[model samples]
Target: MRADPKGVLTGDHYLDGDQACAEGALAAGCRFFAGYPITPSTEIAERFAERIPEAAGVFVQMEDELASMAAVLGAAWGGKKAMTVTSGPGFSLMMENIGLGVMMEVPCVVANVQRGGPSTGLPTLPGQADMMQARWGSHGDYEIIALSPNSPQECFDLVIEAFNLSEQYRVPVMFMMDECVGHLTEKVSIPRPESIEIVDRKWYRGRKENYLPYAVNGDLVPAMVKAGDGYRFHATGLTHDERGYPSTTWQTQEKCVHRLVNKIRQNAENIIKVEKDNVDDADVLVVSYGISSRVAVPAIQQARQQGIRVGHLRLITVWPFPEKMIRELAGRVKAFVMPEINYGQMVFEVERCAAGKAETYLVPHGGGWVHDPKNILQVIEAAAA
Candidate 1:
């Protein structure tokens, strides 16, 4: 699908990750952005507020995070590509409605520019602590698509991918970025509108009288209709049947929620993206994502200089967690070392997926900053030993 030319900022420019992200959303055909102002991530909303008008869309400064999340979900069902941006505290407030979006199968993007802490930690600082929260914060059994961008260029590039995936899967896709990446500056080139491919929302083309909001027609993803498309459809946070009315019976519950989980699970391989280097004969692998992956490069290079056969695997998609790839590598490598700004959030995932085939080590940081390459280097050396 071609992007609307008016919204696509097609050219090369030096931009920060947050600004690049906003351009990405615009190019991806996002017509509505609803968010509350918050540090590190506030730039994303500011940019959207300034730019979305060109596309004949709206940017709303919601009363709070809860309202922002709800508004995004509402806009989505109204047939607009919608999104919201926030930091940790706001991310927490957005959780309930995130589940609502999931239950209603609303297609939207939630970009959480991660900062330090469980509460109001260092708002201006970077942290990868929210990696786990992005997956399991919302209540109930469901699955989500999440992407992590390691640089400003990718920040611009991946937001388009995030929106495309959300439309394809009919779920709230998380664009997880750390404070470092959010604020970091780099050159970004947005392609021409016709050059950018998009996955437009799957609108129901069947008879209006037979519209079923939650019915999966063979592909495990239901077609959608706008609120005023002359189709009466129901949607809610409650467990729902194909008609989207609340359903509490075991059969309805099993059928509805199970499809939600399986749609992403069955398509896991296609959704997962990773970058690997030097694994053919490496004895140890260094795993990281988001900003940490950039910070980890020096450490891996140093390990190679020191005659250690170390490889690197940078996760571009954090959810679905790439269990199959990690599991495969575990059988060949001696150990896996993960360095993140959190104490050990993603390391737990690595350990679980490794499943005893290889030793897993976590080089934990308590946030506020990126990992020192030397710290990761020492761990890599030890893992090689």
Candidate 2:
């Protein structure tokens, strides 16, 4: 229960992934959170409410997911590290504002502790179905950084990385945790404040007269300023120029949107992360993320024991979707096997990256549960064959 002056818990303790996510956000200098209560994801908002005050932070239980996202965007412009949590339907409700956050280039975090379904599928159970939604949920063209955590420890560690990426790229970073990871309790070691690395938003520090909200240098990311800092800047969802004025021309859209997409795309190599085991020389590569990644381990081991040369590739950074690594591996591996809670989401990305160079197999689950290791192993065997 002890925390440093900045409210970072500085010791090891038993915590669920949701709770660890809250602590990680605080440690990463997130001083504001606005979220509505939703199943599986509510514990994150609850933990943040209890702990944020100690960190000299603010927490708001917004009327719904839409306002929650709006408040987070506002808080970020007000010069606070801000975030929100949601699940399933709540996640769908927040998509419009999530797009607004992207168009405005607001630096904030949105955590979707995914549950099952297109609607109210499974409130109490886990699903990794939101993989595509987190990327393409919002309207129009834009890029985002998303991280998938396979364990409670990763929930703590990766959420901090999520915030750092959001700040560094001046974009909304999505922390994609499933119900299994969000509710699973495990030992999470909270590092000291000194040891925790935090990235602050790149603020506009020049003379107020020279401020242009959407202006950028070579990095494609523009500097941000606090809303009340006497900087006259306008932000909107419509296409805008460097001055932040709404412009409907194709040329303006090209300039504005291209940078929005390229800021992450061009720098994706640095932002993407994956955990690899025996990938260099393997006949079959098993690719998974979140809870499915952990569940696939046993199947991979079993396959190895049965004389199958299997490699495990666990995605840590799901979005900016590790195309280069997958492409390279596709050239070497004989086949690829992907297991996810959804019918088939990220597996399509794997298939695209594999580009028919290697055969791809999917182990799909409807929801409410994880794939049986035996089922996964069978697929591994098939892919190897």
Candidate 3:
């Protein structure tokens, strides 16, 4: 099988989610990766390290997750599509740099192959507990795009989407993969480079002297410039003006932070995605993402056989929480049954969107493994009742 000039394999092959994710990044033109080895996510870094040389890309095993995240941001400014991968404790360690990435409007990707966690929980197992952390872990009021992939095939497909979204929005997109999907082997079809669409960062093209680092056009996202490219620009995590200088005042903060939040919030409809099945006439809707979505399939089928009108809503983009769809469905459905590996993270979002219009049931699992189909079925049965 012939790969493209950049060394992306262009054929169908069996792969695990981690390896597929690595290929997806390469196909999407990710030329730099900086990451620390962490459980369930190390394979992604390993695969990228092994294959990146063929693409003339760079891979660095950093001292820790914080340095890994920092290096990713630095690489992005150096005119490279960059990413980093980690899980649980490592994810927590990278929070500060993640906030810096947001404040500086850096375009990059962070993949968290989630394992069971409060601290150093289950290293080799699956968990969906990081859903909320993906949104709020950075310690500020900013917006982010997050994608969850349920299978190895999706792991290949969605990482490309994650990189595209990051470039388009100038935000670090979070790829939330649970350990179950990360380790699951399946057939992944890698399309040719010509067929796959890649979104490069909107680089500033006008006169170098006239460039303002944070100046935006019609879209709230500003155009970028490569570092040391004969362009003088300052980018800081502090509240700054369009020139990217520190101007610590409430006014500057409002203008700086507001656009950061609004850029994604206002365009959420264009950015958010979900998979809906049989929702038009269903009495109960099964809301899930990641491995839980795959596990919920059997329970959904069982409910259908038992004559319950149950539909499934699988979250493809978890953050910017698909509020409008949930609110619309809540008006019609009797209740929403959410089965996530976490105790009750995304279920809260469902409940908030439902807004007391319908009941919300949580089939909570404390991680380590996926939910039992029987447990999910019982919740669906009760929600239908």
Candidate 4:
């Protein structure tokens, strides 16, 4: 991590949401950005390309999203913090390589500014359809960190956190952006250096002979060494053992899989994040995340005005859903209402976390429009009545 002169730097400039994302990556110590330009998300690449050179970093426009993702992985392996940005169609092309990153345990960031999809359903429109796909699209049992930003300022802040978590845990973190966030214009404050805390990838300081690429240390996160730092370690998609060589033995594979999954799963308590409101004493709970949470907030307020015992939980990290927090609410609240831009994605998680302790309902709709919280208030009212 590069150290800047102390004190926060505030800039007052008119910029688009995509520009904020790129700027966020740079502020977070990202030195490499590779991607193909796609609508609604293209501005991110364009902005990064122009800004990276000023930071003495490299920005390359690849031929396709596949190459873009591959290039980022390659850059990360070379010890440079790297990232790529894409929309729905481009995300489709990057999935296979995403799985490769997961298997190899690469540390990088991928910003998906989702437009309507299922083969380019709507290029300029907004949708949250990728929530399910973000967790399962890579085709494996590995864990991923996904952050959904409801505003441009969050776009800037969360991208920094994404890289920090990615390097900290050695995983591919996803910045989940919908059309609203990707297109929204808002003032974002760029904090001073003292306000930003950057985490560098842990490097092994032990003797060369003692280094094992896949060996389990106490934290389960093995220290990483660059490819040419005399580490001489192998990395591949196939299951591998401590020495980084492919292992066909079921025992080794089982251990490897368990560690890979547990490294993130076990740390979920640290990973889960949420925004709660008036939840200390409530009869009904409203669960929502991303831009949809913006709508639900007002609904929660209106319900409170009517003397309905309503509360809310706004999820910040969607992947490792805040199960524990939801469970606490389930025990106290009478019902849970989930509103989202998609038909239903996070609702299932809420249901699972509730564990039959409370009734869970889905208020679902999509197509670039924000969910109406009135539907949620009604749910709270009916459940209370």
Candidate 5:
């Protein structure tokens, strides 16, 4: 249950992962949800469909993921906090429009509850297979926020953060959850409204006279105006100027694209987040995220009990990769090991951050089963030896 700032009862009820995701969005002031049905991820849409009417919001089941994602962008432009949830297959369909969201600077959330894939390998099974895709699925050079949750509670929390980042950066933030977290039943404590920090999209409040949609002012993010609020602005897939008008000039095109890119690229330091445990005097730093992080805790503890100086660093924000922290840890630790479902996704980021200062290794496994920490112990032994 959550209370308004006034401490009124919003509602208090126990919910599974899917239900909790919907409640999280509602609490975060998301008024629109558009998605297609896909297992594990489907319950999120179902919950939203049932709750939105009560929340005085809109819920739409689009014909496909592409349209569903498109509708989310449209809804956000119409001044609604919007989101869509889908699994691997539907997420593939949503990629083109995901690029559109990036190009348009629209604020929206796309939750990818990942199942095994390379074309529907497993519809109802777990996989951390979407980590790399989140960074590269959409075409073009652009930065995006992607958060991975290890547990149902973090799923709810990260969804809220996803909405905040989407609005703050004017980009589509992705909540990347594996089928394990999406289907797992767990007790998640919904905080009071006062406990939540909600960031609404920066809206144009000053005189709308001569408002440039892509204006490069002192603030990197410009205040956005609602589409139907009598603010006439043109949105395009083409290279455009600050006035949101198409530009034929090369210089103008470069300037527009550069600002859009730097607005996020430069803010990498402020956006990246990771959770560290007993790392100060550690010989090995275990790098993991999402559901794999759950396995890492015990691995670190068992290693510690054996007198190995091992620690864990769990990435909460998978994108905007935590380069600085990883770099700092590389100087301190003997080796950095990545345990993920994928063969080698974030392991690349770790190596980049390590820059040969520390040895990096991959303990990867996939196709429905999670990477066990016991395998990680062997890597620790090798590094220690």
Candidate 6:
């Protein structure tokens, strides 16, 4: 579907990541936004609140982050393509409902502009430390789609992809942008309304008398029906069956859980996205994502100048983690060096995927800022040695 011109901020302009994200959501047909302002990420909410009126959208400033997340899910099921924005503290508050959204198979976007933190860590600074939290903060077994944007341009482009992915899979998509990206200004060219491709809601079209809320139709995802849409269906936070009815029986649990996990697992290839450079003949691969991936470019160039066979793999989609690519590269490379602005989150995934076929190393940083190219180079040099 083409975007509606009313929401498309057409033409090129200098935009920070936060503003670009807001514009991207509007351009993608987001008709509702619920958010609580927080540093580094607050601009996203502010932009939406200011522009939504003109775009024929609803922007709500919820009392709290908890309410904000709950509202995002409600808005989604209410037939509005919805989203919410926040930083570390707010992102933490949204975890439980994030789990709820997963269980209910709600299609929404949660944009977390990360800051340094265990709690309210560095409100005004950058952090990639929340990468693990995005994966496991919401207790329970489920998979999510997460995207990392390294620039303001991507901040605009990836949100559209995020929303499209959410609707495509009937799941919540995470837009993970660190503080640096959110605050950094760069050029962003928004295409014309006719040029944008949008994925609309996968609405149920079955006869109302025989509707099954969670019934599978060839694909793992069941089509959805909006509230007050003259269709009878049920939605809940509890484990449910095809009819959206709760059943404590082991059989019901197995069916319910398997579908949630398998829907993503079965379609992993289509969801996984990565950018690679010089990996074919490289002896060491530098694996990074978000801002850290951009920071690694200089270190990679330095290594190449020093006659080292070092390659770069930037993860565009963080969740569903590029397991297959890592596994394949492990068999070819001498080692994989991962640099993330945290003690270590994704490095563990690389280690698991590498499975001892090759060595895996983590270049950890404790947030507030990005890693120095020297640090990454040191690790690459050691790995190359």
Candidate 5 segments whose C-alpha is farther than 4 A from its true place: 1-13
lDDT by residue (32-120, candidate 1, tens digit) is 99999999999999988998888899999989999999999999989999999999999999999999998888999999999998899
**Model 4 lDDT, residue 172, Cα:** 92
lDDT of 6 by residue, 1-385 (tens): 8988999999999999999999999999998999988999999988898999998889999999999999999999899999999988999999999999999999999999999988989899888988888887899899899999999999999999999999999999999999999999999999999999999989888789888989997788999998988987889988888889887788988888888888988898999889989989999999999999999999999999999999999999999898998999999999999999899999999999999999999999999889999999999999989
Candidate 5 lDDT by residue in tens digits, 1-385: 2223331114445666777788788878888999999987998899888878777889998899989999998999999999999999998999999998888899999999888878888898888888888987988777788999888777778788888889899999989988888887887787778778888789887667778888857757877999888887888877777778888688976776677778877898888888988888889988888888998777778888999998888899999888888888899899998888877888999999899999999888875877677898888878877
The whole-model C-alpha lDDT of candidate 2 against the native structure comes to: 0.92
Model 2, 226-311: lDDT tens per residue? Answer: 98878999999999998999999999999988999999999999998999999987999999999999999999999999999999
Clash count list over all predictions: 0, 0, 0, 1, 0, 0
Deviating ranges (above 4 Å) for candidate 2: 1-5
Q: Give per-residue lDDT, candidate 1, residue 64.
A: 100
- Identify the superior model by lDDT, candidate 2 or candidate 6: 6
RMSD in angstroms between candidate 2 and the native structure over all alpha carbons = 1.8
lDDT comparing candidate 6 with the true structure:
0.93
TM-score of 1: 0.99
What's the CA RMSD for each of the models?
Answer: 0.7, 1.8, 1.7, 1.9, 2.2, 0.8
Q: Candidate 4 on 57-129: residue-level lDDT in tens?
A: 8999999999999999999999999999999999989999998888888999999998876788888888888
Model 4 lDDT, residue 2, Cα: 49
By summed lDDT, the worst window of 10 consecutive residues in model 2 runs over 1-10
lDDT of candidate model 3 versus the reference: 0.93
> Candidate 3, residues 218-333: lDDT per residue as tens digits?
79999999998999999999999999999999999999999999999999999998999988889999999999999999999999999999999999999889999999999999
> Which sections of candidate 1 miss by over 4 Å?
none
